[model samples]
Target: MTVVKFLRLPENVDLPLPSYATPGAAGMDLRACLPDGDVILDPGCIALVPTGFAVEIPSGTEMQIRPRSGLAVRHGLMIPNSPGTVDEDYRGSVKVALLNAGKEPFTIGHGDRIAQAVIAPILKPQIVEVDTLSETERGSGGFGSTGVKE
Candidate 1:
């Protein structure tokens, strides 16, 4: 397994570190590190909730920030940029961009599990420009072209 180095901010030293919910979990839960009071996200509003920590990810890998399933289903809370990418080179505090999609306001308490991060390997593909390209069976099929079910 790859080892990741984490630096906890002074303000968040007392907060619990991110951990996997279960043995089979692919991602670790990230909590809100609000120094003040709870944050109220009004409907249709977006906010960047800080995690109050930084990480040193190994090269050729990235941390993907994903929304919590419970929050999305029960409270309509979602990560605006689902599977948000944290490049391996980034060493700044991790923050989650949360969006309130429900009609009612959502309150995010301190230390609440606001998001999850999945550390995964990434591949950089080389791009080649060509005058002609090959076509596929579903070439340029936009939107619902695939129908409701496969």
Candidate 2:
């Protein structure tokens, strides 16, 4: 298992790491953040909640951002940019952009665990230049190249 250390900048920023886990993984807490007064997530209104902390990741590592499943199923809420990426070189506070897809408005209050971030190692691919390239069976196939029915 990878060792990820979390730093809580503020006195109240105690983001539970186990709240965010891999797919098909079960945890102790069903949910952390409690609902506040009703608030709508209209277009252009990025619902970002601050973690109130900054992370220090060693070089060649990155963090993957994901949404809470329970909220998505019950309230039609999700992260606008699913699987948000945070670079190792970044030095800013982490936040989540939540979007409400439901017809009614949703509320989020202070100390509410709106989102979770996971740390992972990053691999950089080498750039190659060549005059000739190889071909494949489905060569040059763009969007909708595969069978639409299938």
Candidate 3:
């Protein structure tokens, strides 16, 4: 397990820190740190909600911002840039860009659980120049190349 250090900003001093919902949970819940009462996200609109904290992530790893399953299923809320990556060297406040796909508007209140963040290691692949590629039965087939039904 990797340990990440988080610094809470002035606006978030009274808010709860991000934490895993359960013992088996892989991601930690992130909350909205809106200083105002609430913000309304109209249908088909997107808003960047601040988490009011910056993190010190270990090198070779990234923090992935994700949407909560309950919000997506019940309110049509989604993270526009799903799995948004926060590089290890970044020191800016973490924020979540939430998009409302439902027909009605969604209200985001201060300290509301808006998203979840997961820390994962990143892999850097070596790039090599190739003249020709190997042949295969399904070489270059994509976008439903295989049969839809079995």
Clashes of each: 0, 0, 0
- Model 1 is weakest, by summed lDDT over 10 consecutive residues, at 9-18
Query: In candidate 3, what residue range of length 10 has the lowest lDDT sum?
Result: 8-17
Q: Which ten residues in a row have the lowest lDDT in candidate 2?
A: 26-35
| Superposed Cα deviation of residue 149, candidate 1 (Å) | 4.1
Judge candidate 3 against the unseen true structure and give its global Cα lDDT, from 0 to 1: 0.94
Candidate 3 off by > 4 Å: none
lDDT of 2 by residue, 38-89 (tens): 3356633557665655566677888777777777788777878987777887
- Models sorted by lDDT, best on top: 3, 1, 2
Judge candidate 1 against the unseen true structure and give its global Cα lDDT, from 0 to 1. Answer: 0.92
TM-score of each: 0.96, 0.71, 0.94
lDDT of each: 0.92, 0.63, 0.94
Give me candidate 2's TM-score against the actual structure: 0.71
Give the Å error, residue 54, model 3: 0.5
Error of 2 at 7 (Å): 1.9
